[model samples]
Target chain A: MIEAKNVNFYYGNFHALKNISMQMEANTVTAFIGPSGCGKSTFLRILNRMNDLIDDTHLAGECLIDGQNIYDKSVQVDELRKKVGMVFQKPNPFPKSIFENVAYGLRVNSMGDKSFIAGRVEESLRGAALWEEVKDKLKKSAFELSGGQQQRLCIARALAISPSILLMDEPASALDPISTSKIEELMYALKQKYTIVIVTHNMQQAARVSDKTGFFMLGELVEYCDTKKMFLNPDKAQTQNYITGKFG
Target chain B: MKHTERELQSLKEEVSQMWKLVLSQLEKAKQSYFSGDIELAREIASREKRVDAFELKIDSDCENYIALFSPVAVDLRLVLSLMKISSTLERIGDFSEGIARHVIEEDCNRMPPQMLEDLQLDRMFDMLTGMLSDSFVALESENTKLAGRILAKDKEIDAMYCNSIALIDRFLSENPSFIHCGLKTLLLIRKLERIGDHCGNIVEEIVFYVDAKVLKHGAKQNKE
Candidate 1:
């Protein structure tokens, strides 16, 4: 489980995230939806200290994963990241073969023998639903695959490390409809093993793929509820207005 | 500074005015049919243009709001439901005109008064009117329970429609000379039934507003 309690984030003097609080369960897909710059991406990155690389960023909230404070000084950022893998909006596959892309995490961590790495690579590729398409081309560079295939490869790389949580920021926004649907299907399948948090601008995508949906605006979590209720009928007037395309 | 509030209020007013015009047309159609007043029937038929215009204006407004604002959540549902409800209302207006045309064609003076009285079509019209009225009220008030009750009341209208068909058959058997009138009354009864359907559609919109559930395809499987 992931929990944020009265979380507030700041970039220099600008308050980027408000006193937001939410709990995301294990092995479920939770979607964050809003217009651009609503701080959904910021919140997602905070889970694994991805924002630590940014300059002048300050946080004053408890973000706990599996009942442990991820922001504690004693915690190792590198290990935290390995346990909580992330995929970005664009498919940023490494400049290497498909097999190497999946094997990159294990290589960096110096985990397992050569045969074990090979076995794990095939398993991650299969888990990402990209094994059949790229099985014969495992030795080929990731750039040789189409945008959709590359995205699946990226997901495979994320899963290669055996992360318990996956954070995706518009994982399918850069792909075509068919590819987007493929990613959605993958997310559905992945949720059985990995707790997933996604940020998206597409309302229909959120409605279709997510178990729970959180609507954010101006860095505040306006409402969080079941996806069906959020899309078909939202409780707050603001939430309803946003989903119905009445106004941003 | 939320533009959605203003647009939603405007949409409500537009639908309200359209409802008023539709109800007026329905009333005028009944008068012309019973009294053999061709002039009033023609007037009602001409007024259909206004309903059509309202539908067009509302459609354009909804499109503009969607294009300009990129609304989400309840505002989006309201716009979508309004677009559907407006089209349904326009179709209802067309049915009203159809009834007006039938009144103008048939020589109502020679028809038996007992024919209209026995069909209880006026009661059906009353129910249809009440249904539309309640649906509009539910929309404005965001009343889910009232909307659910309106949905249930649709069955009453459906039963009345079935009873009308039986009444027409009975009337035809008693006086074969009135077969033509019976057929025309049957067509009018069908139009009223369609109006009930539109009212039901409006009720559906209201339920969407109050509960945030589509209920369009029945209860969805809970993801939670």
Candidate 2:
């Protein structure tokens, strides 16, 4: 479970996320959708503290994972990240072999021995829905796979750590339609074990994949409700206009 | 100003035109029944084909708009309502044609003017026509304020329809010679009643499109 309580974030002096509060249930997919520069991705990164990597960024209020404030001074950022893994818009697999690309997370975190790592690598690949395609070429370079395969490899890399929550920032934006569909299917399957939070520009994808949808506009969460109601008859005029392509 | 908006506007206009045509058919059906204008009855029968054509066109256009735009919320509701409203209008057109058929088949003009008045048939036609025309206005204005008022008019039509049945029964008992004409007049009133019900359906759809509230089953339950 993840919850944001009056969370406001700033990039230098400019506010990136206004006072926002939402709760994402365990094992349910929550999709954040908006136009470009609406801070959906910013709020998603706030979940796992990925924004902390950038300079001059400030955050106020609480972002709690399982009721523990992740932004608290006593909270270990690395441990928090290990508990919450992320996949980016573009696949950024390491230059290592396909096996090591998945093994990289376990290796860096010093988790499991040789045999345990091998079994976890296969399990993570299967979890990402990429095991069968890359199974025979475990020793081949990750670059040898197609774009979609590489993206799934990044998903496998994220899943390798056994994180409780998966933060996906437009994980399928760069892939072709079939690959995008595969990623969507993978998200559906992954939500059984992980609370998936995704930021997508594709409204249809959000409608198809998420149980709950959050509509953000100009750093404010315009609406958050069931995916069915959000697409059928949203509570806000701005949400209706934006989804119907009538926004100014 | 957007492409979908323009397409939706054109679709709305097409339905509006079809609505006006159907309303004219009802008006002409009444004229034929009272004034013995068999020519107008024949014209109503012939124009029924045009009403059917408009329904098919609007149905296909709504389907195309959905496939092309994948509209959401209000746009989606409008397209769906337009599809059902056109279908409801087509059914009303059929009822109007049925009324016109009675005019062509029988000589209702022979019925005593007092008998016609007793049946309240003229008042029924006027109320039905007014309800239909007001529904048209409600849809064209994209306002549902007239929905409650327009839907209530159906009850008046129903009351007249019930009264006509008893009036016809009394007239038939008194003058057994006019039994055939009286029974036929009862059927004509029944057609008008059905048209009123269809008009109520159209008003429900207009409310759904403009206000996104389903009044179909709920309205019926309230009436019950």
* iRMS of each prediction: 3.9, 0.7
Instruction: Return the TM-score for each candidate structure.
Output: 0.72, 0.96
Question: Candidate 2, residue B45: CA error in Å?
Answer: 1.0
Residue-wise C-alpha lDDT for candidate 1, range A129-185, written one tens digit per residue: 999998998999999999999999999999999999999999999999999999999
lDDT of 2 at B58: 99
Task: State the DockQ of every prediction.
Answer: 0.37, 0.79
Question: Each model's C-alpha lDDT?
Answer: 0.86, 0.92
> Residue A202 error for model 1, in Å?
2.9
Candidate 2 CAPRI classification by DockQ: medium
Off by over 4 Å in 2: B107-110, B220-224
- In the order shown, the chain A TM-scores of the predictions are 0.99, 0.99
Clashing pairs in 2: none
TM-score of each model's chain B: 0.90, 0.95
